[model samples]
Target: MPRTGDEFITVLKKAHIEWGNHRHTSTRGVVYGEGYLQIPRSEARTIGIFNSNSSNTHIFNCNSTDGFLVNASIKASGSSTANDVFAKQFQGNGNLRLIGDWFRHVNAQVGDQVKISWTSPTDIEITKL
Candidate 1:
């Protein structure tokens, strides 16, 4: 459950799957550890009425109205952490910083940046200054 802006970018670069970044911004749907992001049209049957994943990781909408376009990737299944979370998912605003299409910023933001960390086994801490 990496949350810091920088860490998020790293996680996205690693993941390479689509988990449905379902979210509602106008409704203020995205929480810290949890999310209102839910199943997409493709995975509607698999996830069923359960619109959102507790892990709050999957955020791939493929241009869906439910959520915005988050720049990240995900791994469906492979590592042990996947089970605890989801097959794989991405749920964050922005972490990838592309500089001139050839470089990127070490930190997503310079200072007073957003910090996301694990506060408990089933929770995450987000500090955006």
Candidate 2:
């Protein structure tokens, strides 16, 4: 029999597979833990990390006008607050960049595991697992 959505999510969660927007991936990468997170472009696009239509070649720098701002409430074991996560696409590697102090607030570090998913269409929740 076919499994329900919640059941599928449960399975994904157990396996540490990334899932959202009817998409899932098992790709894993190293965490910087330096107040920023870089997500694989393909996975980020699949999970709707930012508006898909947003330019993926935009670089973030002084006098920047290429990236977009995401207002999200990041919830970790230690904190829960609305924060601004600047979303940008690396011009060279095309990775998805989420820059903010949220990582510091959550006390993320190298080798830490995190699960990012959409709590709603407009909300993303990141949990350190």
- Which has the greatest TM-score? 2
Off by over 4 Å in 1: 1-112
Residue range 1-129, candidate 1, lDDT tens digits: 322221121122211111122333455432222211211323322332111344443333122111222222211222224333333232332422111011122222222233223333223333233
**Model 2 Cα displacement at 123 (Å)?**
0.5
Off by over 4 Å in 2: 1-34, 50-100
Q: Write down the TM-score for model 2.
A: 0.36
Q: How far out, in Å, is residue 1 in model 2? A: 28
Query: What value of lDDT does candidate 2 attain over all alpha carbons?
Result: 0.30
Best by the lDDT measure = 2
Candidate 2 clashing pairs, residues 3+ apart or interchain: none
Please give each candidate's TM-score.
0.20, 0.36
**Candidate lDDT (C-alpha), each:** 0.26, 0.30
